[model samples]
Target chain A: MTPQSPYALALRQTGDVRDRADFLDQWRELLAEAVDRLLQSGVTGGTPCASPHGPKTDVDAQKTAVLILAALHGGSTLSQLAQDPRPLNAALDLALVSFVAAEDNTAARTGTSSSISKLDL
Target chain B: MTTVDSRSGRRLTARGEKTRAKIVAAAADLIYVQGVGATTLDDVLMASGVSKSQLYHHFAGKDELVRAVIDHVGERIIERERDALGHVSTIPGLRRWRDALVQNNALRHGAYGCALGSLASEVSDQDDAARRAVSQLFIEWQGLLAGVLRRLQDGGALPPEASIDQLATGLMGAVQGGYMLAQTARDVTPMATSIDMALAHIESLSTD
Candidate 1:
């Protein structure tokens, strides 16, 4: 991603004020859409776990979306630092674990799964 | 071991060491707030109140100074993390660590992001030495987390089949990612949630 990307700008704590605000809004929207799609995929079975900080409503998707995006941004930075992809993969896996189907999750926990492929992100 | 100037290759006297530390602390604060690219040596000189010759005596140039700042910041962060994560061997201990992180970030609403992570994003592509230093620090930080997970495994909190290294790496990612999200949102909710999710994943793997 470019240094101007939302994640980069956020990490560096730099960028124009207006641009930062716009990017934040755009990022939230994009992640929220992705979360909605994941939810619609029946992975969460239309009844995801309640978010600790959010009401027991559709807002859970929005919150979950933020968490996933955070994981990507954070994990990618670590990956870049270490020159290894394991950090990113593990972080993303944990971020989206709740969305995995039960059988897939069991398989994953057993080290014999491709549950990440199911999300198709 | 006596600390020597990286550029001059001369050991520092007590007074010289104090001056060098003053410069590094000033640079770290400036870099943390404004970023590496935006921070100029002139700003550091002004902030540190060091003469030009004194600054040059300690560092070869801005790049060297930045590297020093990276180490300074990294050490500070890692030391704090080690202290906090040292006693964590249970899920509740992990959550307490998470709460302290979130609470600390909330003080400034995460406007500053993480010190090492922010430095990594800014310098990883531009400065090879800085990148390596940051990479080393991350490895150390990850190792600390892995140690905690290993403790959990030894205590039967986690299953033998659990990959403690991967879990530790994921937790570190969650922390760094949470810091970025909080910085972006100017709120700690995202930070708290990101870390909580990672902890939840680890808890899911708990044998108890």
Candidate 2:
């Protein structure tokens, strides 16, 4: 027998179908918002505000940017990880570490930390 | 005293420090809302009102900005947890700490998960510093909770064998798991159940 998802069980217990649908929609919105934020932060190339922007500078910095963006983008995958029984968690741990190190080093050299003031958002 | 830029080899000015603070604040807010990957130097520049040259003058590029953001995130988490859980080191503090954490999450309706955990979930596969920072934060947080448990043990309210580290790690996992579950279900059961389960586990361990 296939195992039911914790989310599926949750949906079943809801007496109000409309409420359930609304809840699911809201959750999706939240997840999307999260994903958008991470992508904007620059997990991949082609997006504006990427660390090195276009190519030709440093290959490592560009790769670092990609990993950082990818890590943030991974938020959507939590459900998959939650269900998986393998060493997925360890892999995630390693990936996140690499992203942070890369991002931090690039930022440290860039002096991005030294400019601008407060963000209203 | 002068601080040399690791990349540019230029001396950092006091004004430069101020500008960096501004950039960090702006980047942090952008990352907080947009999740780091989605935020851009353009966003930071706009939010910070810093010109392009000014941005470049400060950060060599966007990667530098992200590093500052992570550092800021770390400092903020440490301070917040310190303030929030400061009272947990006493014999009568266990229940209070538990309630504070539960109520705080409930008040947010689970919309705001732990920022570090959020980042970890987002980038654990790619950022070593961030991964380490998140792990450090968890370890620090767990230590605080464990300290409280140790106090209880000292007061004879808990068993001497009570492993605070294990319990604290368990609590952290539950909270992260709970938030994810709650987000998926768009309901509070995951949050509520996780808290209830953790609380039940703690109580069962109590010798009182």
lDDT of 1 by residue, B60-86 (tens): 888999999998998899999999998
Give the TM-score (vs. native) of candidate 1. Answer: 0.87
Task: Tell how far residue A103 is off in model 2, in angstroms.
Answer: 47
The C-alpha stretches of model 1 lying farther than 4 A from their native spots are A1-14, A44-59, A107-120
Candidate 2 deviant stretches above 4 angstroms: A1-121, B1-11, B90-92, B102-108, B183-189
- Model 1 error, position B178 (Å): 0.9
Interface Cα RMSD for all candidates?
2.5, 15.7
lDDT of 1 by residue, A4-118 (tens): 3455345443577557657766877887887777565544543444445332243357766766777777877877777666777777766666555354656346222245723
Local distance difference test values of all predictions, in order = 0.77, 0.51
- For candidate 2, give the lDDT of residue B92: 42
Q: What is the lDDT of residue B121 in candidate 1?
A: 82
TM-score for all models, in order of appearance: 0.87, 0.58
Q: Is the docking of candidate 1 incorrect, acceptable, medium or high quality?
A: acceptable
